[model samples]
Target: MSIFRNLSSRAKEDELMDDFSMGGAELSEALVHLRRLNKIFAAPGPTRYGVEKLWRMMGSPASLSVLDVGAGSGDVNRKLLEWADSRGVELHIILVDLTEEACQEAAALFKDEPRIQVQRADVRDLPDASADIVTGSQFVHHFDGDELVDIVSHMLRASRYGVVINDIHRHQVSYTAVWLTTRLISRNRYIRHDGPLSVAKGFTARDWKELKRRLNHETMTFSWKPLFRYAVVIPHPLKPGGKESGIGYA
Candidate 1:
């Protein structure tokens, strides 16, 4: 288990452990713990920053449609909706995930929010240009290098404007920090295991560069954010008429 604290672990292969499949009451509890950790760490900050950056670079639209891959419990989408409302921005979100349980959880979470829709489908199967902006939060680390590139391409193809992938940055400090923090605050076994393992499985700067190179798109920009996260924003390659950028590929 201590090996999870080492950044070198990512060199072997992507971690195959997935807590979302645990299902039933245990999965719900784990998801709840995960959401709280996401909030405490400000996981939604990068996605919001990406959208704001888009508005700064491209003109703002009156309304925006967002496709969020691996939406989990849709906690991030809920936060984004509140943020959009405060700014008087009309935002609609389609939360796509492969798990029926996750889709059901998200659907229930956003049932009162008319602007959000929950779908159970693989992101790659979604039609092209399905939304104005495509986004995923803490989701990309689940895939291997090639799979990630392919997923990004699909995301870009489905977007009218851009894509933003917010994930962790693999580093010793982050691995240790997340491990200690989760151990102290969370009793959920899944969180205790997945937290540090996620940091180990996260991407490095070189990994992000390779992913960008594979996409062969010049518009993509990568940055490191606070709380040991990575922000990969790819603005629309073409001129925009519109706007906006989930959880697991697992």
Candidate 2:
């Protein structure tokens, strides 16, 4: 089968960054380049859109806590903090990743920022209703099948308000763009190999639809965003008393 054909199905190949033990200078360099690429593509746009939508639905709380799963380098959360600051809202963000190196990098990046915390753990292990909002950026594409469903289910359970997933939209155009852009901007082997592979591992609207079907979440919505991205937003249901069904904030 030709690589360009069958773009409807998600590619199952593992990315170079899939290895949680990866670290050192090369990993560090690749992360820097990935952060730069995210900025160029406005990768945080979809995430912010989902988050703001949920926030507004929650009546624009003065303070919010966000838990970001598979938060590589935590660059996206940094952008979220900036957005919250601009809007005069306080945001306490928790950055979770399976890799120690990623946690270290995130720690260093937010060393002076008291509002951010980096934790090395799986999202599934987190306590229920630990955060007001749960988000994943360029993260969910790493898994498929039952694992993907379980992870997303846990994210929904872990949040009191909603879940926001911002990830690449698998398409030939996105794949080509990432393939060429990585080659032009990064000499790191990992970036060059995984950039396009990430696009290949991306999802489509049908994929999200299937995932929602599996989870049986009727309110979940998946929408296309700029630069070939998908924002999957799921707002938690409210109780009859006009409060969220989850535990109240302290």
Candidate 3:
């Protein structure tokens, strides 16, 4: 199939970062480039949007604990910390990734920061209700079919409040833009190959709708964001006599 066509379905090809055993200089370089690209594309926007929306919906809690799955380099949460500081919210973030290298990278990045912790583990193994919020940034597209559903179910179960997913939006324009941008700016082989591939692996509106249907959750809300991304927020059900909260979209 031509790379330029057949974007109607999510791509099944595995990214180099999918291998947890990958480590050392090459992986380190790739992580660095990934951080830069994420910043350049404002990739952290969706996660912040989801979290803030949920926080407000929950009546602007004074503190929040977030579990960030597949948290590479912990760059996104680093930005989250800044946002929390500005808003006077006490934020504790746990960054989890399957790769030892990623955990090490995050550890080094957040070493002096007591607000963040880095762990190398499978997200599925996490205990239920471990955090107030669970977030997956550019993470969920790595799996498909039953695995995808299972992973998301675990995320929802692991969070006391909700789960936020920030992922790519599969489109011809996004794929082409990423393909060219990575080639121009990144020398790391992983970044060059996986950047465009991530777009192809991204979700469409119908894809999110189907996943939501399969999960049978009524509180889930998803919306498109600038720069070709989707922010999916699933708030936990309110207790008896609890008032519903509003979600503001971008």
CA RMSD, predictions in order: 5.4, 3.2, 2.9
Candidate 3's displacement at residue 67, Å, is 0.5
lDDT of 2: 0.87
lDDT of 3: 0.88
Give a tens-digit lDDT track for model 1, residues 1-250. Answer: 5734446646344333354445676666777788888887888878777766665554566777888998788787766787788878888889998776677778777788889888888888999889878898878888776787888888888887788888988898888878887887888877787787878778888888888788887678889888788888887664345322221111
Q: Model 2, 61-103: lDDT tens per residue?
A: 8999999999988887767887898888989999999887788
Cα lDDT tens digits, model 3, 30-76, are 99899888887889989999999888876788999999998988798
- The full ranking of all candidates by TM-score, starting with the best, is 3, 2, 1
Mark the regions of model 1 whose C-alpha exceeds 4 Å error after superposition: 9-22, 238-250
| Model 2 regions more than 4 Å off | 1-6, 238-250
Candidate 3 stretches greater than 4 Å from native: 1-3, 238-250
TM-score of 1: 0.87
Per-structure clash totals for the candidates: 5, 0, 0
